[model samples]
Target chain A: MFGNIDRHTYITLSCVILEPNSPKISLARAGHMPFLVKQHGGVSVVTPRGLGIGLASAKIFDANLEEFSLELSVGDSCFLFTDGLSELQNPQSQDFGYEPMLDVLRSPASLSAQSIISEVMKSADSHAQGHPQHDDMTALAFIFKGTNKILSEYDSIPL
Target chain B: MNDVKFTIDHQSFGDVKLLKLQGYLDAHTAPHLESALGDLIQDGNHKIVVNFKELDYISSAGLGVFMVYIEDVRMTGGDIKLSEMKPKVFTVFDLLGFPMLFEIVEHDQIALSKFTA
Candidate 1:
């Protein structure tokens, strides 16, 4: 369905599905960076095999689309980002880079996943030195705080 | 501006020569290094050590420059070895799966020493 859309086309959509008995948080990527999983006081870069969203003809699975399970207990969070976050550069042409991103993740004030995303975006924006984005930037963060209310409030805080 | 800062100098470690780099290695400055290394390769100076004592960063594209010349240098019975990468840069190299591919060391003098040993 995505391949049919032209490159110049722009659309936004969102959906929610509640699967009560689904196995622990599962994510599968095709041609996408392995999303960042934050737990145990460490940031792990998750890289998956395959092409990005547009390459439908390319196989997303061999035998079956296996969802990589990440065990997320309460207080755990994950950040999914595109190339834009790391590619941003400052006036000096220095990349915002991964180290800074790690720093933001480790900051005490950045407790919630949404706060982490906001901090990451702000860091990228500031480091870009008022330069415009070179490409589309998108991030999705999921934080497990043991309940839905806490997660929703944390996710909705505007940047 | 390109972050890499280096002045051309020649040093002899036994029979090998070393060129030291002192800045970041990313898309912006990799071309300069590529050209320098290209010239050395053309001149048949295959035994080389790139001292990265001050290098703080590298991107995947920067890594490509070395990968492109690895086979050529080896075919000539010469090799390119890297040494003295700052921890930040080393982490990037490690993240990109380079430790398994390149000869990396922790000291500039020691890295140059590999060309002789």
Candidate 2:
């Protein structure tokens, strides 16, 4: 498959399939950052050992692929972001990094997924200190509020 | 935002070519890298080293450039050894597990030595 590309061209994907009225979701990743999960007042990352699609032979890519089923508790939140947030650099060339992003995820202002993204974006923007973003920065968050009310939001700052 | 800058400096040591990359490497700048590597491979110089000590950043697009040339060079009994990556630059590759596919060394000299050793 890679042969067709005059040069190496591949896609990085991180996907989660949701079920109706269920906390369980199917997840798959291809050369993407791990999903940031907020649970029990803490934050952690979940990533399977998967290489980017088209980066190697189908055999190798398939062998590395690992699909997972994750069940989140009602107050748990899941986030996936492009490197734009963590890779945000200040004038000094210091990146905002993941720790700060995790901090926001750990204790978002409110239970709403939008709040989670807003807090992180605000922090990331502050990290820039007037330095404009150079890459596409996208953030996604979903909160399993309950059987009826689920909050999710996607935000992006592209340059 | 301002335009991202990238440049490649190439030098040869025996059978291996060393390319020193500087500045940010993102989608807009990856083509330059593709051609730089493609040119070397076209010339039958497969053994190569990419020194990243000076590279400030690398997006997945830059990483994809490697996927394009790796198989070609390896088929000819040569390899691309990466070296001198900054912590941040390495993280981009590491997060995607590039270490498993490519040999990463601490210094450019270490990468060059591996070609002979």
Candidate 3:
């Protein structure tokens, strides 16, 4: 059905399905940027194989599409983003690049997904140096707190 | 206003069509590359090669152009092979996991040989 549409219209997308309290994650990619998975004291990029929508027929899409399953351990974090974040440029016309983004992920301060997102956005803004973003910047982070300790701590917070 | 210009030069090698892209490939310039691929597919020329040696940058929009036509070309018993990419340009494609979905060769001749093979 996608192939029948005009070629000029195309989009990249990524989807992740997770059930509450489940460690198994199902990830689907559609020509989107590779996501990062930080766990076990290391960061790895998950580049799942898939094609973009409206790019081909259902037959081709189904043949090439692959779903990835990941079992997250306690304290594992996953980061998803668009090209806009990595391609952000500074006054010197240099892109923010993946190294810095990875650095942020590797930081010890990245105790939670929210913290990681905040640090990355702050870094991007600083790198931009007042240059307006050329592309839409978006990112999503998921931190797996498998144990009840973290959940109970959240319950202790004042409402 | 950024003065970023993208150009695509088409060259034919037997059944293979080569598109040499230069300059940045963002949302603003993705349509140019998309149209080029569309024309090639329309002409019944499915075997294609895109040279990224001179391409300075490629955004998701630019990458989407490849996804747009790869399956159609493959269905027609043809393929869009990439070649001669600079490391910078290649990194973007690599980051997006294109190397898994597309045939990316180090040299143009290698890509050409694959078409003939």
Candidate 4:
């Protein structure tokens, strides 16, 4: 919606947005990567193929919007990261990929978004062994506690 | 690896300064370009013509930085323009769909003329 075909590289992007007052959170993917959702002792992967917007003649690719839901109790968390993290190559020239990522999640260390992201970056950096970040690194983790957990945490926030 | 070099020059076609980029705009070095443009925008110089005559490569993340700031630049009553992109970079641009949104020209003088006129 910004520019014509010859001026602006239009790589539109979309993601699953959780809204308030909705019965369930929604998930969508468009020319982007998947997000991780964790609940009830299990991990979920949500990735759909959508054309990267600005690629030449990428119109042939179809955009897909898919949703999956999980019942929540307490202490459930979701994680998301860009390829930079998954694709990070260690000093041994191997990727500190999904397995390590899952390991991090299994550990108790990945309870909060900031801590999870920081630890992942540190792990990747350590694996790289002083190699420059070949790509921009980004990560997001969301812990889903029940409504009671939300209220309790909210009540504790100092005004 | 230092295929592209950037420099800032003040031109008085009428009364504006021109900050020019003469290098590859790719992932490996785009952070510097982003910061340069960022500083200029922060300093309130909105009108810009990125002379891409010497530009060699650009990646999606590199493009993202521009897309991220384009709104801010336009909001300030300034625009980002392009000129003299080598065919190599243009191919990258065309492949990525950037040509559709940017003002790309074939010559540096033409880009400057557009800014003045």
lDDT of 4: 0.59
TM-scores for every predicted model: 0.60, 0.81, 0.77, 0.48
Provide per-model DockQ scores.
0.03, 0.50, 0.38, 0.03
lDDT by residue for model 3 (A28-112), tens? 8987888788877788887778866665566776787889888878887788888889888998989887777788888999877
Docking class of 3: acceptable
Clashing pairs in 1: A31-A50, A31-A51, A31-A52, A34-A46, A34-A47
**What shift in Å separates residue A119 of candidate 4 from its native position after superposition?**
2.1
Query: What is residue A56's positional error in candidate 3, in angstroms?
Result: 2.4
Rank candidates by lDDT, best first. 2, 3, 1, 4
Please say which candidate is ahead in DockQ: 1 or 3.
3
For residues A72-144, what per-residue lDDT tens digits would candidate 1 score against the true structure?
5566666766656776777776766667676776677777776888898888888887877765678776666
- Runs in model 4 lying further than 4 Å from the true structure: A1-14, A21-23, A55-63, A68-71, A148-159, B1-117
Model 2, which residues run further than 4 Å from truth?
A19-22, A146-159, B1-9, B27-32, B107-114
Predicted candidate 2 versus true structure: per-residue lDDT over B78-106, tens digit per residue: 99999989988887887676877899999
Q: Isolated chain A: TM-score per model?
A: 0.70, 0.87, 0.86, 0.72
Better model by lDDT: candidate 2 vs candidate 4? 2
TM-score top scorer: 2
lDDT of 2 at A52: 70
Candidate with best lDDT: 2
Question: Can you tell me which runs of candidate 1 are displaced by over 4 Å?
Answer: A1-36, A40-69, A82-116, A126-138, A144-159, B1-8
